[model samples]
Target: MSGGVIGTLGIVVLLVLLLARVPVAFAMFLVGFLGIWALNGWNAAMGLLGSETFTLASNPELVVIPLFILMGNVASASGMSRKLYDAAYAMIGQVRGGLASATVIGCGGFAALSGSSVASALTMGKVSLGEMDRFGYDDRLSTGVIAAGGTLGILIPPSTGFVIYAILTEQSIGRLFLAGVLPGLLLLAAFVLTITLLCWRRPELGPPGPSTTAAEKLRSILGAGPILVVVLVTIGGIYGGFFSPVEAAGVGAGMVVVYGFATGTLGLQAFWQASRESIVTTATVMLILIAAHVLNPFIALSQIPASVGAFLTALDLPPTATLLLILAVYMVLGCFLEGFAMLVLTLPIFFPVILQLGIDPIWFGVLVVLTLEMGLISPPVGLNVFIVKSVAPQVPLGRIFRGVLPFWFAMLVTLAILVAFPAISLILPTTMFG
Candidate 1:
């Protein structure tokens, strides 16, 4: 068989395995390893292993992954999320669809602390889901809001996805984090507006939540004050150029720990549990990433990207048109593929085309993240939807999908705003960091 045929077959086999419930990293690794062996021989594959493992582990940029993950675990264990949700609810739960709106606000705030999409979903699902349920909101709207709001995890600052994107593309992590801020808030606002408009039309969807007295509201703010301070210290320090992303992670983790101890919310057992969980989770992610590192350059060496790029250029389309076409393709792909795998696999091909078209990579990264955020709620393989379903099995999966339909439209609107106004992403990064 020809080398090209072997390579293509390898990818086909990997997809088949993935559909059969194989793990993503394992699927990629099996295809890549055997493809190399089939094309050359076993000795060549053996020779590649030592260098691949060392190079992936030795990467200094990768160190930030565990630190950020640790910070999230610590913050969650310390009860920071409850305080954040209380504060957000107090401030906004009086508005129409108030509980749902507060769900979005709380998710955004928790996303800032955690920087993980799944973690944010799980945390908010446990806390805000119950509150919304108790407030007489529709089960669909309550769980759906938690599911949709959880996507903010990657949009907010200190995101793991952004860190991975920066590492893949060699962009500045600090700048990418800064660039995401405005776009994140814009998304949160769009979500709230969509909820308000919908519930206004159908009052049963989210009946008005009980109003908090001014004194209670003010008191709730005090509970959340530490988180706000941590946000300013971590994000503010990075944007103000006072600290690197790594340094910001340190400060954020330290502050959260201090808050936990001082408030006695997180005792010795909680601290130990958080530490242990952080190690396990970080290790799992790093292992998958290392496998990808071994696999990525081999895919690049196959010259598939060059072939794909040539085909895209041959279409003779305007740059904007090409991008729109690509976005549509990503949306279709998101229905079936995990967002992380899709991003990692396709960027090697598409990112080159984007750079060739003279687009700013930072602006494009934010756009890509927002697009991936949709995958968290899209049909067939929406991880966030599954998370909500797991929590509230009584709510049929069909209802959750139906519930997110309006939200999916809201995402498209948000994407349009980002596309039409690039500065919605770039303005903060350029002004603060440049």
Candidate 2:
């Protein structure tokens, strides 16, 4: 068989392994290595594996992963996430659907500190779900907000999603980071509007939370100030050109560490726990990146991307039509594949086509990450939905899924807006950096 045929077989074997519960990183690594050995030789495969692993591991830009992850973990350990939730609640809790709206705002704030969507979902779910429940918020709105809002962790500045996309596409991380800012806020606003309309229609879905006194509101804001400052300093530094993305990550991580200890919320035990968690998360991400690197060369040799590009070109579809089809495919895949796995599995084929169509990579990154966000709250494999369920065990899994539906539609609206106005994502990155 030809290299392309062997590559196709390798992908099929990979799907079988994944369905059989193989870990994504290991599964990709295995398929990639074996495919290369089949197409080239064992020596070439082994050589590629060793060199790629070392090269990816040794990449200095990768330092941002661990540092930003550590910053988030430590921030959680320090109770900063709770403070952010409280501040948002205090500011907006009295309005109709206020508590759910606050949860979205809180999730956005925490997203700035924690770039991982899982962490954002888990932490915000814990912090705000109960309060919304207490305010008699509908389970659907309460649970849905947490799951949907958690997605902001991947779209806001300091996002690991953007970081990984940058690494994969060889784009500037700072530019992607900036590009995400407006779109993230736009999505957050859409979520809040969803809640408002829900409450406006039913008037009971999200009952008004008690208003806070002026002093109480001030105190809550003050309480959340330190971590907010850290977020600002890091992101602002990057925007101002005072620091590179790697330097911003280091600064953010360092500041969070100091804040954790100074606040006394992160004791030695908690600190150690956060470190271990960060290390584990970092390792998982690094392994996946290495595996993706290994897989990319094999796929290149397989001519899969070339084949895909030629096929798409042969269709003679308009660029807009082709882009929409690709996005639709991503949305369908999102139902079954975890975002990172789908990203690794598909980008080699799709990214080249996107560029060939003259689409902006940074804008496409936002659209792609938004689709992944949808997947996180989507059914069958909605990771964030499961995370929210774990927080609210009494709420049926089905209810949580139902609750997320409106927010899912809200996400669709945001996606449409971004697609129509690419400038929403591109303005900050282009104006500030260009």
Candidate 3:
């Protein structure tokens, strides 16, 4: 049988395994290993298994993953995330839907610290849901805002999604990080605008919160100073060329740790717990990445990318139309697959097509990450929706899904805007790096 046919079969098996609820790493590993053995030989397969495992395990660039995760874990443990939420609340909680907007802002702030959608959703849901409930906010709006807003974790700087995309595609991490900044802020704004519009139509949806005095606002802002400083330093350092992505991650982690200790918020036991959680999360990411390495070579040997590229070229669709088709596929797949799993499964096939179309890798990375964000809140398997439900169990699953629908549409709009103006995703990287 031809390599293309073998590759196609391998993908079908992979999807079947995923549908059977097999872990992503194991599914990819099983398919990749068998496919490689079939296409090359057992000897070649074993050789790659050893070599790729070691190479990825020892990659210095990957260190950023653990560091950034630790920074976020520590921030959450240290009450920095709560303080950030309080600050946002003090400023905006009095307005209609302001509590929801503050939750969105808080989610964005935590995302900058965490670079993880799951963590952002989990942490922010716990912090914001009760507050919104107390303020007479609609459960749908409160839950929906947390579910959708948490997606900012992957679109903001220090994003694991961007990091994974960069490593997989051999793109520059710094450029991808910079490319995400403007687009992340744009999506956050879109969510806020959606909330405003919703409340405008039905003020009862999110009743106005009690106003805060100026002194209270100032005090709340000061309470959040540590996290704000860490965010500015880490992201600013990268743009100013003062630190590489890895260095920025390390610095951010260190600063958070120091703040946690100084404030007596992160005791030794809490610190240890946070560190352990970071290790587990890091291990999971590493395994997925290693499996992706093995799977990537199998796909290459199968010549599937070449086949897909040729097919796309034959269709003779314009670049923009072709891009939309790819993104639409992502949206459909997002309904079922976890974001990172989808990334590893699809990039090996779609990336080559993207390159052939003269698309900018940095811009595409931002776009892809944004699509991943949508998937996090998309129905069927909307991971963030489930997360919000976990926090607010009284709210039905379907209600959470309904709540997120508008924010999901907001994300769709944001995606459209970014697609129409590529510069929204590229300007920072070009101005800073070029």
Candidate 4:
């Protein structure tokens, strides 16, 4: 059989492995290694395995992954995340649906620190769920907000999603980080609006939380100062050209560690635990990235991207229509695949099409990440939904899914707005880099 045919079969086998519950890295690695061996020789496969492993393992840019993750883990262990939530709660908790809105704001703040949607959802769920429950907020709305809001972790600055996309597409990580800022804030605003409308309609879904005194609000804001400073210094340093992404990450991580130690919030045991967790999370991301490099070459050898690109060209659709079609496919796939897995599996096939169509890679990255966020709260494989469920075991899974539906639609609206105006994603990157 031809290489293309063999590549097709390899993809089928990879999907089968994924369906069989194999780990994503292992499945991709298995398919990629075997496919290269089939198309070339065992010697070629082994050479690539050795080279690619070393190249990715030694990449300096990848250091950002562990540092940012360590920053997040240490921040969580140090109670900074709780302080962020408290500040948001003190500021907005008196409005209708205020607690949920606070949760969304808190999630956004934590996302800037964490860059992991699961961590954002899990932390925010633990911090805000009980407070909302005490305020007599419906579990559906409360759970939904946590799951949906947590998605900001991937869209805000310091996002691992952007890091992976940048590496895969060979784009500037700083540009992608800048590109995500406006869209992330837009989605946050959309979630808040959704909460407001829901409370406006039902008046019971999320009742108004108790008002806080101005002094309490000031105290809470002061409490969040450490995290706020870290976020600003790191992200702002990147924007100001004072630091590369990796430098920013290192600085952020160091600052968080120092703050943790000084405040006595992060003991030696807690620090060790946080470091261990960061290492594990970093390992998982690194493995996926390494596997992607292997799989990319196998797919390239198969010429599937060329074939798919030719097919798409033949359709003669307008560029906007074509973009929409690709996004539609991503949305469908989101139901079945974890966001990053779907990203790695599909980008080799789709990214070339995007470039050929003259679409902006940075803008497309924002769109793709937003769609992935939708999937996190989407049904079936709704990963963030499941994360929230694990935190609030008493709440039915179905209710959590139902709760996310409105926020899902809200995200859909945000996606549409971003698509309609590419400038939303492009402006910051362009202005800053230019």
TM-score per model over all chains: 0.96, 0.98, 0.99, 0.99
Q: What is the C-alpha RMSD of each candidate to the true structure, in Å?
A: 1.5, 1.1, 0.7, 0.8
Question: Which pairs in model 2 have colliding backbones?
Answer: none
Quantify all predictions' global Cα lDDT against the true fold: 0.84, 0.91, 0.94, 0.95
Candidate 1, after superposition: displacement of residue 174 in Å? 1.2
For the record, the alpha-carbon RMSD of candidate 4 to the native fold, in angstroms, is 0.8
Tens-place lDDT digits, model 4, residues 193-257: 99999999999899899999999999999999989999999989998999999999999999999
lDDT of 1 by residue, 220-327 (tens): 999889889998999999988898888888888888888899989889998999889888877777766766665566566566677778999999999888888888
**What residue pairs are clashing in model 1?**
none
Better of 2 and 3 by TM-score: 3
Write the number of the candidate with greater TM-score, choosing between 1 and 4.
Answer: 4
Please identify model 3 stretches exceeding 4 Å from their true place. none
Q: Who is ahead in lDDT, 3 or 4?
A: 4
| Pairs that clash in candidate 3 | none
Model 2 TM-score is 0.98
What is the C-alpha lDDT profile of model 3 across 164-229, one tens digit per residue? Answer: 999999999999999999999999999999999999999999998989999999999999998989
Q: After superposition, how far is residue 118 of candidate 2 from its true place, in Å?
A: 0.6
